[model samples]
Target: MRWQKQPVHYPYEHVVCYDLETITDQEMQDGSFPPWPRHRPVAGSFLTAEWSPVGYRFKLDTLLCREGREAEFYRKVDSLLPPGGMGVSLNGRNFDNAVLRLQAQRNGLFDLRNIARQAESSRFDVAHLDLLDVFGARPGTSLAELCRALSIPVKTSVTGGDVADLWRSGNVAAVKAYVQEDVIATYILHLHAAAWREGHERQLVLPLADLAIWLEGEPGLRHLLSFATCRPARWARSRAPALRAAAALAEAELRLKREQDEAAFSAR
Candidate 1:
């Protein structure tokens, strides 16, 4: 694993791990400061997970922004996150939050800026945790590199450098998939960091097991199931409670869906 600039600290219970996909402006020259802000966000993905006694439960979703609808993407992100929930990203302090802050300022999005600031800062009241920063700044310490060191299975289908071209070529699904992988990987790392901080090594695999069970019923996230749940078999016996919690959540969701369907049919 890469060296951490600081100990694995911060005790926030709710976390939103996120990643952004961006495209550069056609008119602007290369080599821009605050590189992400110069580019526009075409899509983003966030994984929301809240800690429970059993483990963390994950819900995954993505946001798509057509060419000029960047502000709407920011608004949707702001609306989706819980109040004061911790934000996690790979290089979020420098890249992701920087982009958000700069773009938010341009669009007069003070609320989004505030959220980004809170997530980017390392102050006493900070609500964001940048795993890249936590791992310390060094060459060869990108998300993929860190994942490799920690034995996490990250998506190898595409690289970040390919995202802008892929999106321009109309491969939005690929971009979304890439972003989802990055965010999920970040969340897994976050769980491990939490486990490290709390001195509970078992905390690592339990959340993965729970997230795997939760993903079983989520068709949209099937791609992540195997990658996210790597090496959880050893924890099978200890994962009973987390599995039960996941089952309950899945059942509740299905029941809610049925109720909604029945109500809609009744209206007809």
Candidate 2:
């Protein structure tokens, strides 16, 4: 029988995992310090909220980066993510975020640069968690390897090198699927890595009581899996009573356990 994998230590309850598929690098013959983004088309992208209540469920979606609409595509993504919370990916710091910033120079995203700043920092930086950078910077460490190592399925049929060919062949849909799979795999890889580092205690640690707060919508990580319990829109706020009652129940349960322990001790 196969051994079960443990859950990772996810300190941040909120995160956004994303992956970008783009055309070949826009080469600048002159190797300048600030390499501006060239006219390369952003193939497409996918992102998930990484937050689910009492289960592994999440909501992930994709967006196509059509011709002449690079800025619009990038803007929607940038705005989709809120100010804080870590962004997880494989080599996102050096590659994905770099491409995003270069392309987003003309867009009006408020915190677009924050991804660059946080993602490029040390591993301890929670703002952005680039698995490649955190994992000893081993040269040529691809996503497929990490996924396989962690027992997560590498869902895509093609690799990054094949994106341009797929696009050329009118398989833009395939490219989107590929990129979306990468996003999902990245998130799974993170859970494994976190489990490796912090060890898993329980699955779907996010409490149902926090459902209202979670639905209230903080940007980034986990946007997959379907569950009717999570259907309520973010606009429908939860009253303090719901949150407090849950807390009160928990506190009472803990108190009862404590009392039982004390009574047994006294009898001894």
Candidate 3:
């Protein structure tokens, strides 16, 4: 596909927005509860993003693994992204990119020589426009807080602390659903901010169907899926065991809850 060098008209000219979910060691060991940092465990997830003009597209991506998937992820991401496009994130520079880079290095996916060259040559000169940074100048602004301020609905069903438990307890469907909601919320915030910057109040509201349609046209989804498809079965298998464990736990918990409810009803 031919890359479009010129900027598109309207709010898209300024930035692209993306969100990620990852499995950390803390989550896995702690049964999906908030992970402790000392463990330095691996994590993975399905990621999604919205490019300006292209709308909100979801991609199954990952972060932190024993396997060498980070290189593949970066390759896919780089392909979809324009060389100089501005990357807009909630607080991506400090958290998202840093975690990705660390995972890449830990997994031995990054070549130090190539990284040096990329840095020296400035070939990867994409500017990061962080929404958190923009909003940080104003006190009491956060991802959820910012969404509220801008009249955007929050889309996530659970907090990051709960993801490990959700996954460990075998709620894959729920985890996927929750992550997808986050992607939608992130996309809406991006559009809302972009519209605000462009002085268009009416464009601030994005319907879910319109967002899905917009995502359908994004060039990034194909790249991410293709990368995932190319990985070895071993990498995928590693996640399977933990996910199974999570499912088992979830089932037991559900059973216990059901019994408790039944007993309470009988007592009454």
For lDDT, the strongest prediction is: 1
lDDT of 1 by residue, 1-268 (tens): 9986764446556777788877776534564333455677778888888888656677777999885776787788776555667777777776776776677677777776445654557733347777766666552468888787777777669987788789888999999988888887888787777676677655565666667677777888888766645654235326656656777899899999999999999999
Look at candidate 1 and give me any clashing residue pairs: none
lDDT per residue, candidate 2, 88-156, as tens digits?
A: 778777767767766666555545655455435565566777888656657468888876664445653
Q: Per-residue lDDT for 28-128 in model 3, tens only?
A: 55444342222332343333344443333444443332344556665554443334445555655555555555554665766543222222322123455
**Per-prediction backbone clash count:** 0, 20, 11
What's the CA error at residue 252 for candidate 2, in Å?
6.7
Q: What is the TM-score of each candidate against the true structure?
A: 0.76, 0.64, 0.52
Task: Compute the lDDT of residue 125 as modeled in candidate 1.
Answer: 32
Most TM-score-accurate candidate: 1
Rank the models by TM-score, top first.
1, 2, 3
Q: What's the CA RMSD of model 1 in angstroms? A: 11.4
Worst 10 residues of 2 by lDDT: 226-235
**Model 3, 93: alpha-carbon shift in Å?**
1.2
Q: What's the TM for model 3?
A: 0.52
Each candidate: RMSD: 11.4, 10.9, 22.2
